[model samples]
Target chain A: MESILRTENLCKYFGGLKAVQDVSINVSKGIIQGIIGPNGAGKTTLFNVLTGTYNSTKGKVYFKDRNITNFKPEKVTKLGISRTFQNIKLFKNMSVLDNVKIGFHTQTKTKMLDAIFHTKTYKNDDRICEERGQELIERVGLSDLKEEFASNLAYGNQRKLEIARALAVNPDILLVDEPTAGMNHIETRNVVELLEKLNSEGLTVIIIEHDMSVIMNLCHSILVLNHGQKISEGSPEQVRRDENVIEAYLGREE
Target chain B: MMDQVFSLIQKLRAKSVYFLVLIGIFVLIFPQLTDNQYILHISIRILIYMLLASSLNMIVGYTGQYNIGQAGFYAIGAYTAAIIATRAGYSFLLILPLCGIMAASMSAFLGFPTLRLRGIFFAFTTLGFSEVVRLTILNWRTLTRGTFGIPGIPLPEIVNFQISTNNHFYYLGLFLLVVMLFISHRLINSRIGRAWVAIREDENAAKAMGVETFKYKMINLMYGTFWAGIAGGFFAYFAGYISADSFILDESFAILAMVLVGGKGTLVGPIVGAIILTILPELVREIARYRLVIFGIAILVMVHYRPQGIAGAKAEGRRIDVEKEYEAGISENAVETTAPGN
Candidate 1:
C-alpha cells in the first residue's frame, strides 16, 4: 500500500529521557491504522510528534509527498492533518456546531473586515460554514445535539463529536488519540463504527488506542511500541500473534 | 417556516434598531436634562472609560487574555499624540488615529515577539510593558519634557471650530464608544470572534483545529489597544493636559476592574462595568479617602460575588475543564498494563 503519511527515525527526547525514539511509521491511504503500546510506550507522544505538537528530535515526516518535519501544529493541521486528543479537547464552552466550525477555520476565506462589516461574501461564507457544520454534525449522528454545549454531551457522544470535529478539517489524514479511553463497551463500539465510517468515506486514520478490541476490530494495520521504540508493525492479525508484540505489549501485562 | 423565521429575525433586528435609537436619543438629551457641568464632565469621563473598558473587553473578556497593560497602549497613544501635536501643531482629528495606530502597532510589535507567554506570563509582560512606556516618558527629557509632560494640549476642531466644551467632547466619547462596541460586536459574532472564543476556551484545540491562535490573538490585541490608544488621545484633550502621572498602572487596574466588575466576555458587561465603576466613586465622593476603600470593597464584593461579571456568558468560576481529559491520562498510563490486547 502507498503511504500517505510517513515518519522516519523520529526521536523526541525530554532531557535525559527519550519519550519517543527511533520510531518510523508509514500510515497508508484510506486505512484505519492503530498505534498501541504499554503505558509509557509513547503512543500519545508518537501521535503528538506526528501531528507536530512536539518537534521530532532528529527525523523527518512526509505527508502526501510533502516533507512536514517540525511544522507548527497549526501548519500541520492546515496541511490537512487533524487530530483529536487522548482525553477529548472539545471547545467545551462553545456550542457543538461552533466546535465543528472551528475545525473549518483554515478552510474559511473571510477577512477580518468581512467579519467586521458582515459583507455579502461574509454572509455567504457564514451560511456555508453553518451548512457544512450541520452536515458534519448530522454525519456523526449528533444532529439533535448540534446547539448543545460540547461539555454537556455524553462521553460517547463527545468522542463522536471529536471525530466529527476532525472531519470538519476535511483532513487527508485523521490522527485520533485514545478516542475510547473512558468509554463503555457500547461507546467503544460506536467509536469503532465511526472510525470505520470515516475510513469508508475516504479518510486515512492513524489512531492511538489502549482498547485492544478497538484495534483488532477496526485497524487494518497495527504498530506496537515498547518504551518509545517500535517493537512490531504489521496487519492486525499478524501483530496479535507476533511474538515481539505479545511479549513487549500484549503479554507484558498478562 | 423559513419565511416565518426570516420575518421573526427581521422583527428582532428592527426592534433592536429601535431600542438603540431610543438609547441614542436619551444619551443626546442627557446634557439638556442636567445642565450641571460636573455631571456632564463625569458622563464624558465614563464614556471615555467605556471605550477603554470595552476595548479591554476585546482582550480580557472575549479573548481571555490576561492583559493588564492597557495603560501601556494608552500612554503610547497619549505620548505619541501629545509629542506630535505639540511639536508639529497637528490637529486632534489627525492625531487621534495616529495615536491609535501607534499603540496598535506597538502592541503588535511587542505581542508578536513574545507570543509564547501563556496566560499570566503574558499579563506580567504586559504589566512590565506599561512600566517601560511610563519610565521612558519620565526619563526622556528631550522628547517628553520629562515629568512636566505636554501642557495646553489642543482641543479638537470641526470646520475650524475649536470644540472646547464638555458637551462636544461627550459626542466624541459617544461616537468612539459606539465604534468600539460596533467593531467588537461585529467581530465577536463572526468567524474571527468564534476563532477567538475557541482560542480562549482551548488554544491547543483551536490550533489543532487549524486556527492560527497567535495571529488571532495579536489581532485581538491590536484591535483592543487601538481603542485604548484612541481613548488615551481623548483623555489627552479631555484633561487639557498630558502627563505620564495619569497613565499609571493604576489606570490599567481601573480598566480591568471595570471589565471584570461588569463581566468578562459579554457585550454589555464592560459598558455596565464602566458606568458603575466610573460613577461609584463620584457617588461616594462625600466620604473622601473612604471612597477608595469603598471602591476597593465594591470590587472585592463584585469579584467575590460574581466572578463572571454581570453580563458574562458561561459560568465565570473555574470550569470543570477538559485539560485533564485531554492530556492527563497520558502520564497516568506510565506504569499501567500494556497497550490493550484483545
Candidate 2:
C-alpha cells in the first residue's frame, strides 16, 4: 500500500521530560493501523503530535508527501487529517444535528447574508448541509436521535456521534483515539468491526487502542511503544511472539 | 392532517425567509401604529439597544466570551460623535459610520491583549476598561466637557432639512436598525460567524478545526462595539445632550440583560427583549422607583422559567430523540469479548 503519512524522528517534551522521544512511523493509504502500549508509553502524545495537538520538540511529519510539522491542528484538519479526542470533546449544549453541522462549517462557502435572507443559494446550501448531516446521523445509526441535545445522549452514542461529526469534515485520513475506551468486550468487538468496514471503503484509519484483543484482531499491523520508543512493529502474530514485546508487557504493571 | 400542519411548522422553523418578511413589514408600518413622541423616543432607544444587544450576542453568546465593556465602546461612539458634531459640525449621516469606525478601532485595541483572558477575568477586565474610559471622559474637560456633559448636539439633516421632530428621529433610528441588523445577519452567516460559534462551543476543537479563534473573536468584539458606537451617536443627537452618566455600568448590564433575557445569539430575541425592557419603564411611570424592581422580577422569572427566551426554540416544549441525533453512540453489551481461541 502507498504511504499516506510519514513521521521521522518525532519527539515531544513537557518541560524537561521527553514524553515522546525519537518516534518514527509510517501509515499507508486505506488501512487500519493500530498503536498499543502501556500507560505513559506516549501513545496519546504521539497521536497529539501527528495531529498537531502538541508541536513536536524535534522532527518532521509529512502527509501526502508534503511536510506538515508544527502546523496548527485546524490546518492539519484542512489538509485531510481529522481526529477524535480520547475523552470525547463534543458541543454538548448544541443539538446533535448542530454538532455535525459545525463539521461542515469549514467546507461551507455560503455568505452570511445568504443565511439571513434565505437566498436561493443559501437555502440550497443549508438544505444540503442539513440533509447531509441527517444522512451521516443515519449512517452512524443515530437517525432516531437527530434533534436531541448532544449532552443528553447515552455515553456509547456520544462516541458514535463524534465519528459522525468527524466524517462531516470529509476527511481522507481519520485518526480515532480510543474508540472503545470504556466499552465492554462486545462493544469493543463492534468498534473493531466498524473500523474494518471503514477501511474496506478506502479510508485510512490510524487507531490508538489499549485493548490487546482489539489491537490483535483489527490491525493488519501493530506498532508497540515503550518509554517513548518503538519496541516492535509487525503483523500482530509476529509482534505477539517478539521477545521484546513480551518482556515490555510482562515486566511493566501497565 | 398532521402532515399539512407539520409542513407549516417546518416552514416557520426554517429561520430565514419568512422571518425577514415579518420584520420588514413591522418596521415599515411601525410609524402608523403610534405617533406619540414618547413612543417614538422609546422606539429609537429600543433600536439603539437592539443593535447593542445583537452585537453583544456575537461575543457573549456566539464567541463564548464574557464582555462587560460594551459601554466603553458605546461611550467611545458617543464621545466621537459628540466631538465631531460639536467641534467639526459634521452632519448626523456622515458622523454615524465615522463613530462606528472609531468604536470598532477602540474595541480592537481593547480586545487584542484581553482576548487571552477567559470567563470572569475577561468580564472584570472589560468592566475595568469601561470605568477607565468613563474616568477619562470625566477628566478630559477640554474635549468632553467632563462631568457636565456635551449639549446642543445637532440632529441629522438631509440637505437643509434637519430632522427636528421625534417622528423623523424614529425613522432615522429605524433606518439604522435595519442597516445594522443586515450587517449583523451577514456577519453571523459568514466564515467569521462559524469561527465564532466554534470558539464559543470548544476553543481547542475550533483551533483544531483550523479556525483562527482570536482573530474571529476580535472581529466579533469590533463589530459589536462599532454598532454600539453608532447607537451611542444616535443617543447623543436624539437626546440633544450626553454625559459620562449615560454610558455607565448600569447601561452595560441593562443591554446584557436584554440579550440574556431575550436569548443570546438569537437575532430577534435581543430586539424583542430590548423593546419590552425599554418600554416597560415608561409604562410603569406612575411608580417610577418600582419599575426597575418589576423589571428585575420579570427578568428573574423569565430566566428561571423560560431561559431560552423567544429565540431559543428548543428550550420550549419540544422533545428531540437522542438516539437518532448524532451517530456517536455504541453498545458495549452486544460484542462478545473472546480471548485468542475462546
Candidate 3:
C-alpha cells in the first residue's frame, strides 16, 4: 500500500537540543499508527514539525505524494491533512456543534457577499454544515449535549469533542496528538474504539499517545522514539518485545 | 371597532413584526413628540456614534483584534468626504461610499502588515497609526487647514430636498442607521462571520481548520473601517465642519469603550454603549467640567463590574473566568463574544 504520509531525515533543534533528529516515518494509508516515547523524546516536537506548527531544521514531509514540508498550517490543512492539539484547543465558548462546524470551514464555499445578502447558496451550505456537524456530534456520543459549551464538557468528553472537530475537516489523514493523554481508562477505551471505527471507514489516523496499553492494542504498527531518534518501527507485538523500545520506555538498566 | 383594536393589540403580542412596525411608526413621528432641535441634535449624534461603535465592533468585538485607531479611520472618512463634497459639490450619498472606500484602503494598508502582530503589539501599532493620521492632518495646513478646521461643509441635497434642518438630519441618520443594522445583521450570520469568530477564539486552531487568519483579519478591518468612514461622511455633513481635534486618540478609546461597556461582541452592545456613553455626560452637564470626572467614574465602575460587556452578561450570563479558561486552554474572553453565526 502506498504511504499516506512520509518524512525523511526530519530534524528539529532548540538551540543545541536535538528535539527530533533524523526521524523518518512512513504511515501507510488507512492504518492506526502510534508514536510512543518517554518525556523529552520529541514526539510532540515531531508532530508540531509535521503539522507545520514548527519549522524543521532539515527534512521533507510528503502527504499523499505532495511535498508539504514547512507549508503553513492552513495550507497543510487545505491539502487534506487535519490535526488536533494534544492540549485540546477547541473554541471553548462556542457550542459543541459549532466546534465541529468550524472543522467544515475550509470545505464550505459561501463568500462574504453571499453572507451579506443572505443568499440561497449561503443558506444551503450553512444547513449542510449544521447537519454534518450534528451527525459528527452523534457519532462522538455528544448528541444529547450538542447545545452545551465546549469548555463545559468533562475531561473525557472534551477529548472526544477535539477528535470530532479534527474529523470535521474531512481529512484523508488525521494527525491526533495525545487524544487519550488525560482521559480515564474507559474514555481511553472508547477513543481506541473510535479510532478503530474511523480507520475501518478509510481514515488514516496517526496518534501520539503516552498511554502504552491504548497504543499497543489500537495501533497496527508502532514507532518508538528515544532521544529524538527512531528506535523501532514495526507491528505492535514486534515493538512490544524490542529491547530498544523497552529501554526507551523504562530507561536503560544499570 | 374596539374589539378589532383589541384583537390587533393581541396579534402584536404574538408576532414581533407588528411590534417592529409599531416602533417604526413611532420613530417616524418621534420629532413631533420631541420638537426640541437640541434633543434631535443629540439623538442624531447618538445614532452616528452607534454606527461608528458597531463598525469598530466588527474588529474589536467580533474578530478579537485590538484596534485602538478607529478614530484615525473615522477621520480619513470624514476629511475625505468633506474635501470631496466641498471640492466636487456632490450629494452625501456619493460622498459616503467614497469616504468608506478611502478609509478601507487606508485600513488595508495599515492592517496588511500589522494584523500579523498579536494582541497589545497590534493595538499599539494601530495607536501609532492613529497618531500619524492626526499629526499629518494637523501639519498638512494646505489640505486640512490645521487647527483652523474646515468649516461651512455644505449639507447634502437629494433631488429638491435639502438635508439641512435638524429634522432632516435626524431622518437621514435614522435611514443610514437602518441600512447599517441590516448589513451587519446579515453579515454576522455568514461564512466570513464564522471565520472571524474562529480566528478570535483561537487563531492557530482556526488556521488548522483552514481559516486563513490574515485574510479574515483584513476583511474584518475593511468591514470595520468601511462603516467608520460612512459615519464620518455623515458627521462631516451633519456638523457642517471637519477637524483633526474630533479624530484624536481619545476618540478611538471612547469608541472602544463603547464596544466594551455595551458588550464586546453582540449586535446590541454598540447601540447600548453609544446611547449610554454619548448621553451620560450631557445628562450630567449640570456639573459642567465635573461631568468628565463623573463620566470617568461611570466607565471605571462599568468596567470593574461588567468587563464581559453589559449585553454579553445580560444576554447569556456567560461571564469569563480567566483562570478557568486558562486551565481549559482557551481564551476566556471568548465568552465575552457571541457566536451568533453558530
Compute fnat per model.
0.68, 0.31, 0.59
* CAPRI tier for the interface of model 1: medium
Kindly list the per-residue Cα lDDT of model 2 for residues B99-210, writing each as its tens digit: 8899899888888899888889999989998899999999999999898999888777878898998778778888888887786777666545666777886787776666
Steric overlap count per candidate? 2, 22, 0
Please give, for residues A4-93, the per-residue lDDT of candidate 2 as tens digits: 999999988766666678888888888888998766677777888998988999999999989999888888988888888776878776
* lDDT for each residue of candidate 1 in A10-64, tens digit (9 for 90 to 100): 9887665677889988888999988888777888878888888888888999999
The number of the candidate with the highest DockQ is 1
User: Model 1, range B1-342, lDDT digits (tens) per residue?
Assistant: 634743564465468778668887999788778889999999998998898998898998777889999998999988887788778988777899998999999999889877678888999999999999999999999999989989978777866988888888888788888887888888887888999999888888898988888999999899999999999888888887888898888888888888887888888789878898888777767774464465577678766655666555554354335355535555545432342322
**Which docking class does model 2 fall in?**
acceptable
Candidate 2: which stretches are off by over 4 Å? A16-18, A110-135, A182-194, A247-254, B1-36, B159-161, B186-191, B276-311, B314-342
Candidate 3 docking band: acceptable
Clashes of 2: 22
Model 1 misplaced stretches (Cα beyond 4 Å)? A249-254, B1-25, B286-296, B322-342
By TM-score, the candidates rank as 3, 1, 2
- Whichever of 1 and 3 has more DockQ, that candidate is 1
